[model samples]
Target: MSRGAEARQGLTLIGPPLFYALIMLAAPLAMVVTFSFWTQDYLDIDTTLTLDNYREAFSQPIYRVLLLRSIVISLVVTVTTVILAFPMAYFLSFKVKRRKTLWLFLITIPFWTSYLLRVFLWKVILGYNGVLNSALQGVGIIDEPLTFILYNANAVVITLAHAWAPFAILPIFVAMEKIDRSLLEAAEDLGDGPVRRFFRVTLPLAMPGVMAATIIVLIPTVGDFITPKLVGGTDGLMIANMIQVQIGRANNAPLGATLAIISMVVVSLIAVGIYLAGRKFGGRVE
Candidate 1:
């Protein structure tokens, strides 16, 4: 085919997806950005551009506190999920000799159910009169149910970690599978012990997957309101919950848009920082 014809054909193939993204993603993002600079009255929106929303978002102690809490909670969930996932991914990638597909299917059984259902299930398991309390009582482990296990930041972290576990595992498993086994054998031949070999060869090569899993888990978990709403109680509520309130009951679309914009900026900065830091560390290791 001629060059011009080839270019036209390529554009034809990608045009639908590009248009879809423009409508679905870019257009909504633009609206949010525009609204962030606007003001909201009780019954009407002031379309005139202003920084009042951003100012309030920054000046308010509650917004700052919630934003920080959201970041911390997300970090906790990301670390916990990745750590827990690593072992399963490792076993599947290196140790599983048969039925890996079956094992993976079982791992993903949780996804087959609705995400809200999973959150509710965790709530039930952790509630005062729930399965965990009943089991502990039956075993005589405690005279009273543990109130500390539910309705807090800890509960939020646990629920989010559990919810995102499979997401973390898949990326790491793919990364592990891509690793050259010959490098590991060579390390062993050079008198490297199992632990040393893993640190030098396996872990370094798997960093990309680990980083991918971290980003995937961290970003969504930070914005997650459903889990926190269902199981987090007051102490567990994150920025997303506050945003929901602003947009819904509070009827302050401008403020909600501002908060959402700020969140996206903060997440973008953190993600960039993490990528840079990881790259620097990886380069030093090399």
Candidate 2:
């Protein structure tokens, strides 16, 4: 094709996506920025502007702690999911050839159900007299129920990790599967063992996928209110949960809007940092 033809084709393809992104994302985000500056009284927002919402957020130690804790929990979940997904992705991509589709399908099967239902199911399983306790008792693993399991940090982590597992696995698996088998055979022929080849070749090639998965899982984990409210109790509450309380119970719309904006900024910064870091690391790989 001529250069002019190619240019026209590219524009035609990109125009729709640009329009969609602006309408779907940019417009709503612009509204949030507008709302953040205005004060809401009851259902109506006043036209006046104020910075008290931000000042209040900074003044409250609990809000600051919640923000910090959300970041920490999201980071932990991102790291843990990557570690756990790596081996599974490797198995699907390099080792298991016969049932690859079946395995991938199963990994993503839980997502076919409702997201809220999954959160509620975790609550049921982790409750004091829930399935875990019953199973443990039946098997004589523990004589009594563990109340902490249902409403704590551990429960949130466990449940969110499970919820986010497929997101990490699929991307990593796709990256690993893209690697040519001849590359592995070439490494083996050079007397490189499995571990050496992985570090030198497989891991480097898969870094982009790992980075993609990390960003995906971490963003949702940070903004998740359902997991925190259902599983994480008073001690395990995240920033999102606090924002919910501010808007719902405290009747503090400005504070909630401010917190949401800050949370968005923090998560965006983290994601950008990860993306840049991933690009740098991927460049170093091969």
Candidate 1 lDDT over 1-286, as tens digits, reads 9999999999999999999999999999999999899888777999998999999999999999999999999989998999999999999999998998998899899989999999999999999999999999999999999998899998999889999999999999998998999999999999999999988889888888888888899899989999999999889999999999999999999999999999988998888777677666544311
Q: What TM-score do all the candidates reach, one by one? A: 0.96, 0.90
Candidate 1 error regions (>4 Å): 283-286
Q: What shift in Å separates residue 271 of candidate 1 from its native position after superposition? A: 1.2
On TM-score, the candidate that comes out on top is: 1
What are the clash counts of all predictions, listed in order? 0, 0
Among residues 3 or more apart in sequence or in different chains, the pairs in candidate 1 whose N, CA or C atoms overlap within 3 Å are: none
Where is the poorest 10-residue window by lDDT in model 2?
Answer: 277-286
How many clashes show up in model 2? 0
Error of 2 at 84 (Å): 1.6
Q: Which candidate should be chosen as best, given lDDT against the real structure? A: 1
